[model samples]
Target: MAVLPVCQDCCQIVTVNKNGKIETHSPEPYGERACNASGLLTGRVRDIVVSSALRAHAVRRSRPTTSWGPVRVHKSGLLPRMPDAAPDAMPAPKWLPHLKGGTLASVTLPAAGWLGVWLPGYAKPTQAYRVEALTQRNVTSAWSARMECWTVNNQHFLSVANALMRRHEKILVGREYNPREKCTSSCKAARGPLCTCSCHAKHHGGGRWMAGWCVAEEFGTVVDGSRWHWMITGKA
Candidate 1:
């Protein structure tokens, strides 16, 4: 006798005999109704089974396998792993008073008297001012090539964070379009005014924007297993 698999959906038994013939049977009545009487012939049933098996195989093969387990793929790419926790030596500090207003720029203390500022990109005016401010005060400061942030002493961290916050607010105010403004065809065509709303920023590249706060580990604190916050600027 050949082992048969029961269809859990309909509680019907499907089997392939020794002679390579497929068969399905409807079990006895339960309650007032019998198991689904609907049935498929050998050829049709075999085709459905084979197709389902092939699809399952393909799906399994397509998944990315990691030492931990299989990871599902997303539209952007493979799903990102969770950021590692910050080490005891470097805890996440409270955001500066200026940054608490929900600005894009942020500061992290990777070590005592040392600050790391996350900017949208390298060589922006804000980054230049940060280094300049520290230098003007005769404090140690430089762009960390490895960490990708302007590292300065705590003596000027407050000033740099405040300046960047003000500059960021000014740039946002200078924009002709507000977040509440509806996106227009011109914005889509990249011809006329562009909206600063999240929708427009995501779809049309209307303007540069960054959102979401990051933990200390995601900054230069932990270094090895940290992931940056998702940036709407499309680079992330």
Candidate 2:
């Protein structure tokens, strides 16, 4: 518990007891020890130092080793969560038809056969139609045979997906379609709202866009344009 002095001649150290009696042999002659030596390094001091060191070590170990592990990132709801494949993972539209009757904006696969197609400006189904956007704009009657009218944009699509997911509904995934930058406007006579087009010229050449499917349910209306907005109604 004493801080002994080094010898000036031999440069060695020596330890002494309280009565000025040399306790350990060394080449150095240390100073005499006093009665009270509580502040000097002793058992309690060693224990405290060891405990502090151990605590610091434990705290360091408790932290995450790497910042790359389990990272939390915020994501935009509109964009579909594509896999980590090549940028051009989806090939050309060899399966989709080149029909000109109406611009089938989106064909989502809610499951199988549960396709939600959006056609803005002008699309008149010659046969039956069975779909309606929760946000049907000016349509007075709900078209049981055909979709009245609907508009969708990138943001609106994401909004609808979020709403449907919250409602515990599966997204209808349509057949893959290239996105088109230009969108057609459905007429006032049509049953739906002003539809927006998902047209990316460079990616999807012939006015095509990737389509996500959804079930036709009364949840909400999504405005399609450069800035999409979702107006939630009932149990969205």
- Residue 232 lDDT, candidate 2, scale 0-100: 15
Q: Write the per-residue lDDT of candidate 2 for residues 36-151, one digit (tens) a residue.
A: 11112222111112245444332111111122222121131111221212332222122222223212223332211223433222224311132234324432222322322332
Model 2 bad stretches (over 4 Å) = 1-155, 175-236
All candidates: TM-score: 0.26, 0.18
Task: Give the Å shift of residue 137 in candidate 2.
Answer: 7.5
Q: What is the lDDT for 136 in model 1?
A: 55
Backbone atom clashes (below 3 Å) for every candidate: 0, 38
